[model samples]
Target: MNSTKIPALSENTNLRYANFIALYFAEGLHMGMLFVGIPAWLAMQGKTPTEIGAFAVACSLPWTFKFVAAPLMDRYAYLPMGRKRPWVIGAQLGLTASFVALAFVPEPLQNLDILNIAAFVASFCGALQDAATDGMAVDVLEDHQQARANGFMGGARMIGSSLALAIGSWILNVHGFTAAILAISAMIGLMTFVPILLREQPEEKILPWTAGNASIQNQTLQVTNWSIILKSLYSLFRLRDSMLVAALMFVSMGSYNYFETLLPLFAVKITGWTNTLYSQAFATADLIGGIAGLLIGGYLIERFGKKRMIGIYFFLIMVITSTLILSKTLWENSTFLYGFIITYRWLNAFAKIGVYAIAMQCCSKKVSASQFTFYMTLGSLGSMAGATLIGPMKENFSWDLTFFLFVVLLAFAWLIMYVINIQKLTTQITNFEEVEPADKMNSLLPNF
Candidate 1:
C-alpha cells in the first residue's frame, strides 16, 4: 500500500478549529432547519404524517448514497484551488442556491414536488460537503485528538442544529415559509466566507495556487483512478473488525432518529405545544445538554477508553429512551416534560459523541473520505430506517409501544458491543496494513 502519511496538524489550532466548527455548523443548520422547519410548516398546513415523512425522506435520501461521492472527494482535487476547500465552497454554494430557489416556490404545500426536489438538491450538496469535512478532520487530527475533536465537532453540530431549529421554526411560525427559507439562505450565504478565509498556507507563505508544494498535491491525487478506489474500498471491508463496527453503525443512532422524527408531532399531541414552543425546547435542551455532553464525553474518553464510554452511553440511552414513554403520563406537568426532553437529548448526544469518537478510529487516512463516509452512510441508513418506520409504528401500535421497541433496538446494539471487544478491535485495526493490489495478486498464486 502507498504510504500516504496523515497531514501534520495545522499550526494555528484556533483557525483549524474554526474551519471544522464553521463547516459543521453550516451542515447542522442545513439539516436541522430542513427537518424542523419543513415538517412543522407542513404539519401546520394540515399535511398528513406520511407526507411529512416523505419530505424528510426526500431530504435524507441523498445521504444514503453519500458513499457514492466519497471516493471522488478522496480523489480529484483542483490543488491550486485548495484541496478540500473547493468541494466545501461548491457544495455550500449549491445549498445556498437551492435554499434561495426554495423561497420562490409558490404554495409549497400544494407544490410539494418543487419543494422536495429543491430539498433533494440541497441534501446532495450537503452530503458532498460533509464527506469533504470529515475527510479534512481525519487528515488534520492526530489519533489522540480524535475524541476531543469529535466532542467539539459534535457539539458544534448540535449548536447549529438547535439554532436552526429555533430560528427557522420561529420564522416559519411568525413570518411565513418563504421568509424562513430566505433567512436560512442568508445564513448559509454568510457562512461561505468562513471557508474563503481558510487559506492553505500560513501568513508568510504564498498561496498554493502560485507556489504550493506540487509533490504533496500530486500525492493527494495519486489514488484517483477507479481501480485504486475499488481496491481500497474492498480492503476496507477486509479488516477483521469492520463487521462489528458496521453492525454498530446500523443500530447506534437508530433510536435517536426514530424519536427525533416523531418528537414534534408527539409534542403537539401530548404536550399541546406549538411549533415555536417545540423549537424552543429543542434549542434550549439540545444546546445546553449537547455542550455538556461534549465536555463530559471528551474528559471521560481521556480517563476511560472509548469502549467503556460506549458501554456507559449505551446503558444511559436505553434508560433515557425508555423513560421518554412517560412523557404522556406527565403531560400536565410542562416542567417535567421539558426536563425529560432535555435529559433525553443530553444522553442521546453523549452516546452519539461516543460513537463518533470510535468511528473516527475506524478510518484509514488513505481513503479517509470514502472509508469514513462508508460508516456514516450506514449510520444515515439507520436513521432513515428509523424515520421511515417510527410514524407507522406509532400510528399502529401507539407511541408507548413504539418507544419500547426502539429501546429494544438500542439494547440489541448494546449487546453487539459486548459480544465483540471494541478495544481489541480498535487495536487490531490500528496495526493492520492495507496490502497493495499487486501484492494481493501475487499472493493469490500457488507457491512452488
Candidate 2:
C-alpha cells in the first residue's frame, strides 16, 4: 500500500519520455539546419568548398567543448523548477533568439566571417540546450530505461532534422534564407512550452514566480562541491572499461558525421542535383532511418546487448558502404544514390543508441552530468575532426580511396570497442557504492 508512489517526477514514464522527445526534435531541427541545410545552401550559392567546410567547423566546434558547460547545470539549477529544467528552458529560449539573430546576419551565405559568428553563437546555445537535456534524462530515467530513451530521443532528433532539411530547403529555394530560418526558429520556440508546462517532480514550479516548491527528493540529490565532482570523475574514469569506452567514443561513430557532411557536397555540387532535391532525398532517408532507430534498434539492443548490437550494425555499415566503390558506373543514377544514403542512415543506429546507452552506463550518480557529457563530447570531438578533414581529403584523394580510408577508421574503432567488457562495468558501480561512506553519499547527487 505504501509503495505505489512513482519515484521519478511523480509522473508516468511515457509522458516524461514524450516531453524529452519533443525537445530533442527541436534540437535536431537546428542541428540538421546547421550541419546539412546551411552547407547545402552554400554549395547551391557557389561558395568554395573551403569556406563551406570552415563554416561546418565553426558550427560543430561548440559541441566538443560543451563539457565545460555541463558541470554548471549539474552543480546548480533553479531547483524549484527542477535541477536541469532551468538550464533547458534558458538554453531553449536562447536557441530561438540565436536563430533570429542568425537570420539577420546582414550578408549572404558567402560572407564567411559574419556567417560563422552567427553560426557559432547558435551552436553554442544548442550545445547548452543539449547539456541540460541530457542531464534531465540522467536525472529522471531508470538504468533500464536509458537505452530505449536514447533510441527514442535519437529518432526524434533525426525526424526533426528530416523536416528541417526538407521543409527548410524548400523554403530556402523558393523564398530565400530569412524566411526559412524564421520558420525554423518559430518551430523551436513553440516546442519550448513542453518543458515549461511539465514539472520535473510534483509540486515543482513551472515558472520562476509560480506557487510551486522544490521537491525534497531533488534536494537530497544536489551536488554540493566542485572538488567532489572532480574526485568522483577521476575515480570513475580510471577504470579500464571507462578508459576504453572513452577511446571508443573518440573514434567510433564519427564516420557518420564525415559521410553525412560530405553528402551535401556530393549530391549538390558533383551530381548536379538541385539543393532542394538533395535535401528531400536526405530527409526521406532520415525518416526511414529515424523510424528504424526508434523501433528496431531498441528491440535488438534488448536482445543482443549494446556491444554485440553495435558490432553487428558496424559490420553491416562496412559492407553497405563498400558497394559505393563497386558501383562506380551507377554513381549518377539517382535511385542508386538515394538508396545508398537511405541504407547508410539506417545503419547509423549504432551512433543513435548503442554508444549512448554504454556512456550513460558509465556515468556515476555523483557526477552523472559531467561524466556523461564528457564522454559525449569525446565523440563530438571525433566528429568535428572528421568533418574538418573532408575538404582536404576530397581534394587529395580519389573518391574510392577516400571511402576506403573512412571504412578503415571505422574498422579500427570497432576493434577497440570489441575489447570492452560490459560485465566489469557493473562491478565498478558497485565498488563505488562501497567506497563512499553512507553519510558522504548523502551529501552528493544520486541517480533519481
Candidate 3:
C-alpha cells in the first residue's frame, strides 16, 4: 500500500502515542496468556508445579537472551517504511502464526515436549517484536515524550495482560483451548495493522511494494557493518556515567526480581495462605499498581526529573522492604500482607518506566536497539543472580537477612542515581560519533 495521504507517525502526536501504547498492549497480551492464563489452566488439568514451571522456563529463555539477536535489528531491517517497523510487523505475523500453531498442538497434555517447543517458537517471535518495537520507539520519539509514552505503554501492557488472563481463561473453560489461542492470536494480529498503516517518515513507503524510498532519517540511522556497531558500543562502554546507569539498571531490577521470587514462599509456606488467594490478590494489586503508574509515573518524572523520581521510588521500596524485615510479628496479618504487596508493586512499576526513560536517553540512534538491549540484558543477569541466590538464602540465612540484602542493593542503586550526570551523558549521546577507524579507539565516549 502507498502512503495514506497523512502525516508520518513521528510527526503526528496523538497517533504516535496511540501506536506505542497499542503495540505494548500487544506485548502484554501474549505474556498474560503464557504466564498467567496457561499456568492456571495447567494447574486445573492436574499438571505438577514442576511441569508448569518447565513451560515457563521455555517461554522465558528467549526473552532473557534476546539481546544476542538485538544487533540484527540495528544492523538490518526494511528501511523503506521505517528501519524497525518491518521487523515489528514480521515478528508480529510470526507471533500470530505461532499462537495458531499452539492452538492446534495435538494432545497437549500428553505432549508437553511438543507444546514446549511451540511455546519456545512463539516466545522467540515475541522477543523479536519487543526488540523491534523498542528500537522504533527510541528512533522516532522525542526526549520529552519518552517518559509519558513509556508510562502509558507500560499501563497498556499491564492492562492487556490482565484482560488476556481474565478473558482467555473464560474462553478456555467455556469454549476450549483452541478458542483461547485464537483469541490471543486475534488480539496481536489486529495491532500489527497499526505499524503497517503508518509511515515513520511522511514520504517513505507504507509497503515495500508501493512506490517510495527510505527517508533520510532512516539512512542516517542505519549501521553499515558489524564492525561499526561493535566499535560504537566499545566506545560507549568507556563512559563513566554509562557504566553507572547500567549498574543502576541491574541492581534496581535485580532487587525487584528478588522480591518476586521470595514472595510466594513467604505468603504460602510461611504465612499459611493458599496459593489461589496469593495469586488472585497479588494479580489484583498488580493491576491497580499498573494503572497508578500509567497515570502518575510520567507526571512525576516530568516534574521532579528521572533521577529524583527513581530516588523517591527506590527509597519507598527500601522503606517497605525494611518494614517487612523489621516487622516479623506481622507476617500473618492479612492487612499487612496485602498492603505490602500493593505498595511494593506500585513502586516497582513506577521505577521501571523511569528507568526506561533513562535508558532511552542513554541510547544513540546508531545502535539503539543493541545498546538498550544490553542494559536490559544486564537486568536479566541481575534476575538470574537474584533467583540463583534464593535457595541458598533460604538454606543458610534468615528471611530477614535475605530481605535485608536486597534492600541494601536498592540503597546502592539509589545512591548511584545521585552520582550520574544525565546532562553530560546527553551531551555524549548527542555528540556521539561512529569510530572512523580502529586506530583512534581510546579503550571512550567521543568515538562512539
Candidate 4:
C-alpha cells in the first residue's frame, strides 16, 4: 500500500478512537471464550488429562504459525473496508459461527470423535481471528499509541479471560455444560456487532505477493507455503544476540504455557474440585495477579529499567515455581492446596508481566510486529514441549515429580536469562543510533 495514503489520525481522531475501542472489546471477548472458557469447559466434562492438553495445543497452534499468514494481511488491503478490517471482521464472524456450532455439539468429553473435530474447528477459527486482529491492531495504530494500545489490549484480555473462566465455570456448575457452551457462543456472536460498527480508512495501493519484492515482504507470506518465509527465518537468526533473545523467549513463554495448560487438570487430580470452584479459584488468582503485575511492571520498568526488572522477575518466578511444586509434594490437605494454587497463580502473574514487557521492549522498530509474532510462535514451542514432556513424565513419574520437573525448567530459564545478562543487553541496544525516535518513545512506556 502507498503508506502515505493511510488515513491520518488528525482527520478522524474521534472515529478512530471509537473503532479501536470496539475492536479491542470484540477481540478480547472472542479470545476469552475461545482460549480460557472453552478449554476449561471441556475439562469440566470429564475429558482425559491428555485430551485437555491436546486441546490447549490445538488452540495455540495457530499462534505458532501466525508468522505465515501475517504477510498476506500486511500486503493485501481490502479495497472498500480497509487493509486489515476485512480480515478482522471475517475472522470474527467465523469464530462466532464456530462457537455457535460448538454449542450444538454433543458432550465432547463423552465422545472422542465429536470432541476432536469440534475442537479442531474451533481452534482453526480462533487462530485466524487472533492473527487478523493482531495485524489490524498493528496496521491501524500509530507508533506513539502502541503502549496505550498494548495496555488496553492486555487489560481487555485479562478481563475477558477472568470472566470467561469464572462465569463459564459458574454456569456449568449451576446448570450444565451445554448451557455454558451456548452462553459463550452467544457472547461470541454478540461481539460481532463491534466490528460492524467500526469504520476503516482506505489505502492508496496494495502490495502483491511476488518474487521481485522479496526484501520487503516479511509480514504477508505464510511460512508453510512461501519460500520467502525461509529467508525471514534466517534474517531473524542473524540479529545481534538473537540466540540469547530466542532462548529467553522460549523459556519465558514455555514456562507460562506449561503451567497454564496443566493447571485445571492439576486442580482436578489433587483437589477434586468441581469446574465452577476451579474456575473461580483460577479466575480470582489471575485477576488479582494480572492487575497487580501490570501496575508493578509499569512502575519497575519506569524506575528500575527493563533488564533489572527482568532479572528480578525471572528469579522470583524460579523461586515461586519451585515453591509451588514443592508445596504440592509437602502439603496434601484441601486448605493447603487452595492456598498453594492461589499463591502460585499470583506469583506467576507477576512474573509473566515482567517477562512479556521486557521481551516486547527488546524488539527493534523495523521488525516489531514480525519479531513479536515470531517470539510468540517460538514460545509456543514451550507449550508443545510441555505437553510432550507432561505426557511422558506423568506416565513414568509421580505428579509430585512432574511438578518438580516444572521447577527445574524454570531454573533452567533463570540460568539462561542470567547468562544473557538481558538487562545489560537492553542498555546496549537502546544506545544504538539507528533506533527510531518513535520506537525510543515507545520504549519508555509500560509494555506488559
Candidate 5:
C-alpha cells in the first residue's frame, strides 16, 4: 500500500465519513419499514402475533446469514469504478426495486406472502450494502477514528430509521399502503446517489470508459480467495478473546429485539394508539435520544474507558427494562410513556454504539468486511433467538413475566462482560496497530 493512497485527516476524510453515514442511514430506513412500519401495518390488519413474528424472522434471517457472502464482497470488486462503491450501487438499486415491487402488490393485507417476500429481498440487499460500507470504512478510517466513526454511523442509522418510521406511518395513514411503499422507494433511490459520488481509494486499474485509460483497464489482481478467507476465519475464531467477544455480542442486549418486536403491538393493545402515534413516539425517542447517545458515545468511551462505560450503560439498560413492567400504566399516560422511552432509548443507543465500536476494533483492515461481518452475524443470531422466544413467552405468560425474563437474560450478558476483561482486548487491538497490516492479520488468524 502506498502512503499516498491513504487520505490524510483533511476534507477527503470528512467526505468519506459523510458518505459512510449516508449509506448506513439508507440501510436503516429499510430496517425501519420492516421492523416498525410493517409490523404496525400487519397488526392494523389484525394479523396474529405469531404471524408478525414470522415476518420478523423472514427479514432478519438474511442478515443473520449474510456472513456467508461477506468474503465474496471482500474478494471481488470492479476496480475501475471503485471497490466497495460499485457493490453499494448495485445493492441500493436492488433495494429500490424491491420496495417498488412491494408498492404495487395489491391489498397488502391479503397479500401477506408478497409483503414478506419483498421485505426479505430488501433485507438481503441492505445487508450486502452494509457489508460493502463497512469494508470501505475499515479501508479508509484510521484506528483513532474508529470509535467516532461507529458513533456517527450508529447515529445516522437511528435517525434514518426513526424518520422513515414516522414518515412511512404518516404516509400510510394518509394515502394508504401503495403510497407508503412508493415513498420508501423514492427515499432509497435518492440515498443511493450518495455512494455513487465517492472516490474509492486510487486503484492501479482505471475505468475502461475513460478514453486514455485503456492501458490500466485490463489489469486485474485476484487478492481474495476461499483459502485466504477460510484461513482468516479460522484465525479469528481460534482466539479466546474472539470467543468471549462473540458471547458478549450475543447476550449483551438481552431481550431488546423481542422488546422492540412487541412494543408497537403493546402500545396499540394498551392505549388504542394507531400506527402513526406508535411510530411517532418511538421514532422521536430514537431520533432525539439516539443521536445524543451517538454524539457522546465516542467521548464517553475515551473518557471513562470502554469497559466502565459499557458496564454503566448496561446497568442503566437493566434498570430501564425493569421499568417496562409498568408500561401498561405508562401507556395509559402518554407523557410518562414518552419520558420512559426517551431515557431508555438514549441509554440503549449509548451501550449498543459502544459494542459496535469495540467490534470495529477487532477487525484488521486486510479482511475488514469478512471479520466484521462475523461479529455482526453473532449479533443477528442473538436477536433472532430473542425474537423467536418472545412470541411464545408472550403467548404463554404475562407481559410482566416477559419483562422479568429480559432482565434475567441481560444479567447473563453483564456477567460475561465482567469476565471478559475488556482492557485486555483493548490492549490486543493496540498491539495489532503497531504491526503491519499483513503481519497483524496473520497473527490474528494463522494458516494451519
Candidate 6:
C-alpha cells in the first residue's frame, strides 16, 4: 500500500459511501409518499372515519406480513442486478403501476373498493421494497456506517413524506384526485431510477451441501420458507421480558393511529374546521413531528439512552392526550382550543418518534430485520384493535371518553415498559457480543 495512494483510495471509498446514502434516501422518499400521501388523499375523498381506519389497516397489512417474503432476498440471487436490487426494481414497477391505476378510478368516493385494492397493491410492493432495502443496507454497510445510513434513511423518509403531503394537498385543491394520482404515479416512476443506478454488493455464501451438513442446509432452507417465518415470528414471545415490550409497542402505535385516524373527524366535529385547515394542520404536525423525532431520537439514543428516553416520551404523550381530551371540553373557547390543538399535535409527533426509536433499538442484530418487522406488525394489530373499538367507544361513550381511553392506553404502555425492565433489555442489546461461529455452527447442526 503506497502512502500517496491512501488518500485517493479514501476519496473513492467516500464517493461509494455517498452514493449508497443517496440510493437509500431515494428509496425512503418513494416509500414515504405511499405511507403519508396516499392516506391523506383518501381522507380528502370524503371517506368516513371507519372507512379511513379500515384503509389504514389495509395499507399496513403487507408490512405485518413482510417477514414471510424477507428470506427470499436473503436466499436468492439476481445475477444481473444482485439479490436485493431485483426485488427493489420489481417493487418500484409494481408501485408505479398501482399508482397509475389509482389515477384512472372514476368517482373515487364511489369506488372505495377499487381505491383500497389499489392501495393494498402499492402497500404490498412498498413492504417488499422496504425489506430488500433494509437487508441491502445491512449487507452493504460496515458497522460504523450503520448509524449514518439510518440517519440519512430517516431524514429522507421525512423529507419525502413532507413533500408528498405538501404536493398532494395542493393537487387535491387545484386539480382533483385523478390528477393528484397521476402526478404521484409519475413521481413513483422517477424513483425507479434509483435502484437502476445503484450497485449492489455480492451476496454472502453459506456452506455447500454435504451428508452431515445436509441437515443444517435443510434447516437453512426451511428458514427461508413461510413456515419458519411464522416460527421466527412466534419466537418473538420467547425473549425475556418481551411481552411488555410488545405491549408497549402495540399500545403506543394504537394510540397514535387512533389519534391520526380520527384527526380530520376531530377537526370537523370539534372545531368545525374546513378541509384546508384540517389538511394544513395534519400535514404540518406530521412534518414537524417526523423531523423533530428523527433529530431528537438520534440525540436521545446517544445521550439519555433508549430506555429512559422512551419512558420520558411516553409520559409526555400521556400528558398531551389528557390535555387533548380536556380541550374538547373547552372547545367553545377558541383561544384555548387553538393553543391546545397545536401543543397536543406537536407533543403527539414528538412522542411518536421517541417510541419508534426505542423500539428499533430493542431489536438484536441476530434477528434485527425480522424482529423489527414483527414489532411493526404488532403495532398494526394494535391499530386494527383500536380502530374497531374506538368507533363504538365514541358512539356509546363520548369523544372525551375516547380520548381518555387513549390516555389509559398510554398508561398501559408505560406500565408494560416498567414491568419488563426496559433498561435491562436495552443494556443487554447494546452490550451484546456476536455469537461465536463454533457455537453457531454447533447449534446449526446439533445432530452432527
lDDT by residue (1-448, candidate 3, tens digit) is: 3256767887897788788888888998999898788888889999998999999998998997668888988898777778888888898899989999999898888899998999899989999998888888888888888888888878888878887877888999899888998999999999988888878888788887887788887887788788978988877877888898898888877877887989988998778888778877777776887688678877788778888888888888898899899998999887799889888888888888898888887888888888888988888888877788788888999989988888888888788878988888877777664434354255244543
The runs of at least 3 residues in candidate 1 whose Cα sits more than 4 Å from the true structure, single-residue gaps closed, are 1-9, 46-54, 106-111, 173-178, 199-210, 215-222, 259-279, 293-296, 321-333, 387-402, 418-437, 440-448
Residue 99 lDDT (model 6): 76
| lDDT values, one for every candidate | 0.73, 0.80, 0.84, 0.59, 0.73, 0.60
Candidate 4 deviant stretches above 4 angstroms: 1-65, 79-83, 105-118, 136-151, 169-182, 189-233, 258-277, 293-304, 322-330, 358-370, 391-408, 415-448
Q: Candidate 5 lDDT (Cα, whole model)?
A: 0.73
What lDDT tens digits, residue by residue, belong to model 5 across residues 296-413?
8666876676668878987887787777686566657767666777887788787787787777776755466787888888887788788898778989998788777877877787
Candidate 6 off by > 4 Å: 1-64, 74-86, 101-117, 134-155, 172-179, 189-236, 326-329, 333-335, 364-367, 396-398, 419-448
Candidate 2 structure, TM-score to reference: 0.85
Query: Over all chains combined, what TM-score does candidate 3 have?
Result: 0.95
In Å, residue 74's CA in model 6 sits off its true spot by 4.4
Q: TM-score of predicted model 1?
A: 0.82
Over 112-165, each residue of candidate 1 has an lDDT whose tens digit, in order, gives: 888888888888888887888888777666666777677777788888888788
Residue 287 displacement (Å), model 1? 2.1
Assess candidate 6 and give its TM-score to the true structure: 0.71
Candidate 1 weakest lDDT stretch, 10 residues: 1-10
Which whole-number lDDT from 0 to 100 does residue 441 have in model 6? 30
All candidates: TM-score: 0.82, 0.85, 0.95, 0.68, 0.81, 0.71
Task: Say which candidate scores most in lDDT.
Answer: 3
Candidate 6, residue 41: the lDDT equals 64
Between prediction 2 and prediction 5, the one with superior TM-score is: 2
Q: Which ten residues in a row have the lowest lDDT in candidate 6?
A: 204-213
Best-to-worst ranking by TM-score: 3, 2, 1, 5, 6, 4
- Backbone clash pairs for candidate 2 read none
User: Candidate 2's residue-wise lDDT over 1-448, tens digit each?
Assistant: 3221333344778867787788999999999999999998898789989999999999988887778898877787778888888898999999999999998887666467999999999999999999888888877777777788888888889989988988998899999899999999999999998887777887787678867788887876677788766667766677778888888888874776787777777777656787677767878878987888777766677667887888888888888878887778877788888888888888886455888887887676556678889888888778878888798889999888777777888888888888888667766665674454444344333344
